[model samples]
Target: MAAVPALPVSLSGRFKGSFAYFTIKDRLPQILTRVIDTLHRHKNEFFEEHGEKGVEAEKRAISFLSKLRNELQTDKPVTPLEDELPDAALWNQYLDYQRNLPNGNGEPSWFQSPWLYVECYMYRRIHAALAQNPPIDNFDVFKEGKAQNFFESQEAVIALCTYFQELLKNIKDLDEKQLQEELFKLLQVSLWGNKCDLSFSAGEDSSQKSSPLQSLENMVPYILVNDMEKVWSLLVNAKKNRTERSNVRVDIILDNAGFELVSDLVLADFLLSSKLADEVYFHGKSIPWYVSDTTKHDFNWTIKQLGSANHMWMSRCGINWEGNLKKGVWVFHDHMFWTLPHDFSSMSEVASDLYAELQKSNLLLFKGDLNYRKLTGDRKWEYSVPFHQALNKFHPAPLCSLRTLKSDTQVGLKPGQGEQIQASESEWMGELIFILRHLIELQ
Candidate 1:
């Protein structure tokens, strides 16, 4: 078989005066300021937790974050990561790749490098700051916002949990068509959940403000390309094709916390209870990222929150979700590569272990915009570019990107459709959805 080629990574230069550039120059600095202020506000708590040493560490982290912000503002070249984390080497190696790109000058700067690289570097640099400060090293600077977002969506969380619990009780009695309808419904719920990201909202509230389950049907018109049938067919047909469908695995590349995380769990629970998947694995970030992207801490905290909520059905769902973990049917995994800025196409070369593990799954569902960006390589493709082309070499298994359009770059649109939407709707991109199907096919 021929080796698959990697897709082009979006450069900040190509899209100057675009969202990508604005993010690096203005928005990123604002985010860094919040992070620095967050550390300062927590200084007293750190001191209480780790004494004077913790206070000193907080100051150090703050100092490091402040400097990082300045570098972005001034277009300073991105330096090699100074961390002991195993993935730091992969990151630095990728930096070398960027530095050697056709550009004349050697060093990769925020304004000159791939948007994905520099954006991801921002988060890793944040971790490096805290990592350099021992006492507060393990503390997530974004935890408070995550917690607040989750609590703010309490009503939506309860409604969705209640719906899932009800579905579980009657799932056995549900006919194939009813099950399919519910599956598609929940999937759409999960898709819309992508909008609940704080990073896209610039550190403001972006939680689901209403009952997601109730509004699922009404949002159907917004899905520009719907291949829910293909996805469902992939699962059911895979069942028929197999001799025995015992170890069917579905990997969910998870997105945000709060209601978005809850939506993912609800979908996971449905997949399990409906027997669409026998085992489910969730991939989360290793560190705080994109404001609300799920970290291991966020993943575990969401389950615990659900398990201990005052609402009966939500609490029940949480306990059972946790039990799935105990029974080894549901698993949570965190890999440094997910947090890295590299395109998914580079996984085999950069994080072969993660790529190989993904190949074991029957299906992989990537949620939210950043994962979507990485999957599509965040490149400028013709609107009608085949989604598989955008995927490049990332066909590890049967995979579907269940993402809402948040970023400017998107693929898999029909001819002239992109131009039409660009003209008609100001926020047309975010308001639409598209799904393409590929199943366990490797070239």
Candidate 2:
């Protein structure tokens, strides 16, 4: 197994005034409060369904969550997960690993541990709280927020679907140059769609309000790294080199649910319609995650909502997506490996099956900030570090990350570019970046 990179220290809340600190100190507690409020607000609904047991379950869950919030605010030590789910033992083992790290800070706590590990641990604990409460074990505390995001982004969804449908009508008539341009446009639409992240805004309403297609040109300057040309070249060359019996598979590790999901779907549709890829695989979370990350439920719900919509173009697009899934032209997968707190570097050792599966793809597209952080190990790397090095020998295939910076860690930039932006803009981290890196030879 490859060693974890000894680069810089992992990004943690220990750095005062940093984004990690702000997230732990302010954003996280706000999210916890919202979860507690949601449980309390739904007490009457629980009573209607499961009667006394449901109401009792709801009360107990709320009490657990309230106590969880207090622990975080008080900087209490991170505790072991008690739920007997398949991943629970692993979670407890990870806690023990954190506690015994060389040069450790005694026991891992909310504000003193690695931001990625502790943040993930908090969500797992939230699940455990409800999981132990029986009648409510299956309930999703984040469901309401995810559904609201989908409903609120209706206008943007309609606009994107309409534009995509029109583009498909004449796709075959376009020249290679025109095809490349269209690919670039769709990729950017998917990239900027990341702005709808609810976690970034602390469970607030972060849906898209305007036309996503119209805003692409305006957002171009915000991309610190643009690798569209290389991505296009790689796809085109793969097509040229393929035999009639061979297939080019593209895997998209998805991100936020609402407008962002629609954007990713549109890009996948374009890939199939343009013959750039024969099949597209979408990977989502098995559990509710990061406030807005897509899960299997959210994926099917969005498709169903789109298919049953009143608008013609939107409904047609949804029906087409449904057909793609049925025909195996599109596939959706949720691996437990995604929800675990380990970095990609640990995948070969901890989740070898998933790592092997990714090795089959011709191209991998990882969407949003959290995926980017995982790709780069959520560490403090120098600005000009090469993209492949930041990956820490975790390459399974040629991959691209369509991420909008919403965190403190970023890599694969020019010498002074990251510093230049940081000095001038307090919110510079909230911009888009398109990165392509190939650490291993293509299969």
Candidate 3:
């Protein structure tokens, strides 16, 4: 295994009055409560489907989750996962690693350990609770919330689809400059779409209701870091040097399941439509994650919803996307590595296969704040620390992070910029200020 970097400390809930503490004390419990309620509300359905067996499974899963929630709330020692999932051994090994840390207490609890590790461990434990029982093994507790997010964002979805269709209609006639401008606009749209994250709201409704394209110009100033132009140039240059036009590949590591997903899909479609990328690969969580992260089911569900919509341009875009999937222009991948607690720097040693797959991409577009947190190891880094430095040794390909600042751990800012923002907007980091970063410093 790769040694942990000797850097700033990990963000932990042990520090009171911090965002990590708030997430552990308030948001996590709120999400757990909702999951429990959802299971309880489905008792009759379980009975109807699997009779007593299903009902028993539901009850057992709920009981396990309730206990897990209590452990988190009471700051009990983090226990080993008892279920026999494929990754159970790996998870326990990680726990051992935590116990062996230099600041070891022998028992890493919810509030005292790395916030990222504990937060991710909570979701993984939830999966194990359900999977331990037979009938409910494949159940997704967060499915209803994800569908609701998509349904609630229908208006914005239509608006975004309409704009994309218009762009496609004129894409062939546009000059190079116009293409770059359109790419920048879509990047901005994707960046801001990250605001609709259910986890940040503790499972509350947070769907986009306004037209995303219309807000780009107004929201430009809030973007603390904008590297869209550098991203565009890299794509253009790669295309110029390649003998085969169909060789360029772009990978999007997706985030939420609602409108943010729609935004990512549209961006992927545009990349193919404009010939900037010949193939776009999407990476999603293997399990339902963080209340809102995408899974294979969510990805297909969104496309199916779009294809079945009554609107003209929306349905056309959906049909086109469905066709793109059929033609292998767009691909979806779900790896267990994505759902694990490891940071990006450990991917080579821990998930060598996934890391090798990422290395084949010409450009990697990591979406949303969770991905940002993972990329930076969720550490307490200075604002002026360079983005590459924060990443430690993980650089599989030329990458860009399109994220909104919904967490306190941020890097790659000017000396005075972070201070200025902190003085003016006290809650700015958690309020979803747009941020974009390019990892071409190592290029």
Candidate 4:
């Protein structure tokens, strides 16, 4: 077991502000109240739409939610909880353990859990908070100004579309080798960019908001010069070994919207154009989640934004965008699999279906900080633990994680690296970003 670092004597003022304003005092309870009311308002309608079993499930869900809301509102003792729901027990256990941890103040704050559990807990708690705090009898937990700012930022969107146009044009002249090299460079850029993207400090906008792709307009020289060679070699080797002519499919478990989504799309496009993948499947949130997770609407809007650019660069990519969507090569799925209360352990139950679909794909890319938290089950892992070990049995497809560290759970650090970071008195695990890729065939 890894020794717990000595606790800081006083919580960082920023951390305190985050909990007081976002998690415990303001946003969470409000969100939970809205979720409860939504359930009640939708209960009869859901039953009418689905029938007896659906109604029963809805009722039971509402009951659990109501109790959860009450607990948050009253600041009740952490209940001895378990996720014994036939399908998601491990996830439940994780949550239960997180709630049971001792917070710095010796009273458990809702925010004090392993990264994965606390994040999910926050969302669930928000659902309950929204349910309890109805606004004139309607649920509107997502009324923050930033989300609106993102959608309204037409100039930023246009700038990204223009960039994509230029990239698409440049790709036409590249040989297969060059394409592969470009893909790798984009991947690194995407990975490094994540470090700047998470909300590490309270009151600060995430990296996605602060530095959009437009910020990188001047850095292309460094990217092409520094990252191109190694990626080219890897791509050449990968191509040479191909036995059967198989199309590579890339799956992205997507994250945040506005600028972050644009960056993700840029990388995805590079993968496809470079012949790294023939198709891209995007997995998105079922409901409003994580304050920034993409939804079906968000996905479509992104495509439209890319297509709307009149520049030649945008037009070339744009012309082919809808075609890919129609060919079923670019797909989006929003099943409960995404919103499952458990961590990747829940993947086991749906392994057959998930594996079948992913088996055809060459790579499965997971994005953002929250997904990283979930992938590792947000355990209090020794930072030195191997990534694969922390992943336990959840390996499916040739996978890579692109995440900016936002939470405490991390793995795959070098010897003594974890200790060094700790000695610095900095939030190293939470601020450093990583890109870990593993090919299933190699293992």
- Which structure among the candidates has the greatest TM-score? 3
lDDT of 3 by residue, 1-443 (tens): 99865799999899898899999999999999999999999889889988999999999999998999999999999999887888889899999999999876568999999999999999998888788887878889999999999999999999999989988889999999999999998998898899989999988999899888887899989998888889998999878877754489999999999999999999999998899988999999999899999999999999999999999988998899899999998999999999999999999999999999999899999998999999999999999999999999789999999998888889999998999999988888777367988878535
Candidate 3 off by > 4 Å:
1-5
In model 4, which runs have C-alpha deviations exceeding 4 angstroms? 1-70, 73-115, 125-159, 175-177, 192-245, 309-319, 432-441
Indicate whether candidate 2 or candidate 3 has the larger lDDT: 3
Residue range 180-246, candidate 4, lDDT tens digits: 6556556655655454332233213543333345444454432211323434444445556556775
lDDT of 2 by residue, 1-443 (tens): 98774678889889998889899999999999999888889989889988999999998888888898899889899988877899988888889999999967889998889999989988888888788987878898888888898899999999999999999889999999999999999998998888899988989999898887887787787777888888898899888988998898899999999999999999999999999999999999999899999999999999999999999999999999999999999999999989999988899988999899888788899998899899888988898898888888888989999888888788878899888877888577654433333333454
- Native RMSD of candidate 3 (Å): 2.0
Higher-ranked by TM-score: 1 or 2: 2
Q: Can you give the TM-score per candidate against the true fold?
A: 0.94, 0.96, 0.98, 0.68
Per-candidate clashes, comma-separated: 1, 0, 0, 25
RMSD (Å) per prediction: 2.3, 2.1, 2.0, 7.8
Residues 1-443 of candidate 1 have per-residue lDDT tens digits of 99866545574644676778877777788889889889989989998999999999998888888888888888899999888877788788888888778742468888877788889899889988988789788988889999999998888888888878887888899999999999888888888888888887778887787897777768877776677888888888766665573577889999898888888888888888888888899999887888888988888888998899889998998899889999999899998888877889889987899999998887899887788888878887787887888887678897888777766777777899888888888666545543422334534
**Winner of 3 and 4 under lDDT:** 3
Q: Model 4, residue 287: displacement in angstroms?
A: 1.4
Comparing 1 with 2 on lDDT, the higher-scoring candidate is 2
* Model 3 TM-score, all chains together: 0.98
The Cα local distance difference test for each model comes to: 0.82, 0.88, 0.91, 0.56
Clashing pairs in 1: 398-440
